[model samples]
Target: MGQIYDLAIIGGGVNGCGIARDAVGRGNSVFLCEMNDLASGTSSWSTKLIHGGLRYLEYYDFKLVRHALLEREVLWQIAPHIIRPLRFVLPHHAGLRPAWLLRLGLFLYDYIGGRKLLPPTRTLDLTRDETGKPLAPGRFKRGFEYSDCSVDDARLVVLTARDAADRGADIRTRTRATEIRQADGMWQVTVQDTATGDRSTISARTLVNAGGPWVENVLAVGAGVNAKAKVRLVQGSHIVVPKLYNHDRAYIFQNADGRIVFAIPYQDDFTLIGTTDIDYDGDPADVKISTDEINYLCKSVSEYLARPVLAEDVVWTYSGVRPLYDDGANEAKAATRDYVFELDLPGGLPLLSIYGGKITTYRRLAEEALQKLAPYLKGTKAKEGWTADAALPGGDFDVSAVDALIAELLRDYPFLTPAHANRLAHAYGTRAAKMLGTAKSPADLGQAFGATLTEREVRYLMANEWAVRAEDIVWRRSKLGLRLSKDEIAVLDQWLQANRAQPANPMREAGARS
Candidate 1:
């Protein structure tokens, strides 16, 4: 028998990566496999907020709201580079919930989660506040401003996985778990390399199915486990348009259908408006934004914005199927955002399948998962809760130190343009220095692949992060896809293909598994 790992996790989303990071810190041997690149699934397609579900308050899900709300600061502290406070402007609609009720909801939101660091909610005068300047004349008079956080959702997942890999967890991307079976009191997991068509088998004492939308399918097809728990697939879609507002604050508009849409300042050039909850019945991987969903988002935002956003204004659109735990909710919007775990330890071998969770509370979910699996794995020194205060990779500095870091980079790398320097500092934090090395000019950074993307940065992503394809770098690792032309992208693709056969560094090769 080969070396049996303490845990084998099957997913590369936030939950899986979070669990791997937590479990590995506890001194447990962990092996994680993803069918595609990290954060390529629902993880990358989030509304990109580390927030308490404000709308969930209507359903009286105070526990979930509080839990998620508490995580906002915790996550911000740990990954300050990628997670930052975002004040949301909730404009009151006379046709919908009353202002007093909104005030009461904001009150509960402020105090329920041991609020600290973030500012308290306050009433806003739309006519006077700069936040309302983008709104139509006399359309909204009063609003409520509350605090949440914006996150680089994809970077969060990748950084978590990087942390786990750094701590000796075997992290494999583009590897699919094909079959799982119990053999002699251990889990025999068969994984296939999607790129090479190579197969390998590994044994583990425990298994975790953290496949977001594919959680049910992982249990039924991958592990052949008959699960009693059901997952409701809800499709949420978003569209990106030219910047709708000049201010930094995000807007949350209340719609007639009892749903709310958010218009957030995205990447300095665009505003991200999203999310319609509709029942999804197809493959999660094939999910795409529909015309109706796009129209709904445009119409939703048009109600408040000074200028209407037409379909022609949209630059990009994405959709993801949320695998919510089916709670018999009448509508997709009503589905619980809380996570549920179903542990099946048939014949003394454990298989923990996870269902339904939002990104904000992923760390808590991971801690809970380890606690449940602790009883089954004896003699394993798994630490209880340490992730709350731990900084993710390249995020060891204070949130206020980002500007200092940027200034230092600008001084050190004089050849870098201000925009390029700022982008690097924000994307990689202190690690940007390592990528820059002793380069005195842009030419030293190798060929430029449009925008500020250089060969040096591309090589860093491939060598350290599990970035194998052009889409992986352009789309998930960075949103440079929005800026790069098709021709530039084709050049990037060609470069990646040409460099595919090269051997990776020792550090990266150590964590990667076939």
Candidate 2:
């Protein structure tokens, strides 16, 4: 017998981490386990936008649209470092959706979800606008510019988990929940550390299955719940290419097939164009960008841009499986982005299984999950919607002050390049100084990996952010993978392996023991 937690979350995606943060903030003891690194799955593979799904409006998903639309500013305010408002250029195609319908959609998009800080929708003359320069000449005359926010999606997950850990929730990465069973009115979850081959059992009054694409697998295989899956695994793929245009704005182009693709600015040097929606039946872990998906993305964006994007132009491609709630839509693109929950109180224990949700709606989904489990979470303060006002770690400053913060970092760290200062300001917010730790020169930061990554930053990620492998630091913790050469990455990986004895954060240390 062991200490029974108030909540046990099985997943480390955005939804799971968000729920853990919310639950722990309400004074409930929580334990969260992820089979791999946080956000290594679908969460990191998003189009990187915090937006009201404008396309969902055509499917009459007004509720989801409004809910997501409202979260835009909320997320931006809380995490201005990793999340900020990004204007998008929507060039109207004469052969596709009508202009009147586009206007109606944009109107709904602006008003719905209690939009406050973001600018309202306005028409654009693409012929004169600089945004049109990248498009084919004389083809797109008029367009619309609207407000949405781009996010470092992986950072969002990591920070949420970090906040939860700071607030006393146990977050275990590289830990798998192998089996779940009900005993003595408690749900006992048997977990294993994937890295060390160690096992333990944790008991909880309530359990959450936030497995994303593996939601059904968790229930059927881990808990032996035999119910049919309520999820539809839809694969979405994206490709990264060299910067398409010099402008900062993103583009949302509509195709003849009624599917829309986004070409968003990424990492200051690449255009992230994606994502194609197709039915996926393979293992979620094995999902990868197919040749057709690559060709489709290239053709779709090429249809609007002056310079055609060929497969040769693709620098990288990634794909993820979205576990959409099975709504029986004819096409994957038409599936509902809204989430659904299945609560099973078998023998007086609460087990909540989540299916299908977008990044923008994860907070709301977490709040609702708490509401459903409120009865079981006794003696907990259960403060409702406190997360709305609470800022994640290092995100305490005002949203409008990002540039000021960057300048402040440059002033404090005179040796840092302007680009380095900007990256630190955006990645760590006010905590950048803490990571730098009074270092007066590059030597104080220890060995410098390519792409401005340093041994000091690497240690900070491992100790504070649960970053273990080189991929965790380069790909998930930061997009330095794009810049670090293979040799540099190998060296970093070797260094990490050699330095595994560095002190981990208190929560991580505790997680290892548990």
Task: Return the TM-score for each candidate structure.
Answer: 0.97, 0.97
lDDT of 1 at 309: 96
Once fitted onto the true fold, the runs of candidate 2 whose alpha carbons sit more than 4 angstroms away are 222-224, 503-514
> What lDDT tens digits, residue by residue, belong to model 2 across residues 209-271?
999998987886557465454899999999999999999999999999999999999999999
**Candidate 1 lDDT by residue in tens digits, 1-514:** 8888999999999999999999998888999999999999989999999999899999999999999998999999999889889999999888899999999999999999988899999999999999888889897899999999999999999999999998999999999988888888888889999999999999999999999899977876556578999999999999999898789999999999999999999999999999899999989989988999999999999988889999999999999889999999999989999999999877778899999999999999999999999986653584578999899987989988988988999999999888898888878887778767767888988889999999888888888898989999999999999999999999999999999777244233323321
Where is model 1 poorest over a 10-residue stretch in terms of lDDT?
Answer: 505-514
Clashes of 2: 0
lDDT of each: 0.90, 0.91
lDDT of 1: 0.90
Model 2 lDDT, full chain set:
0.91
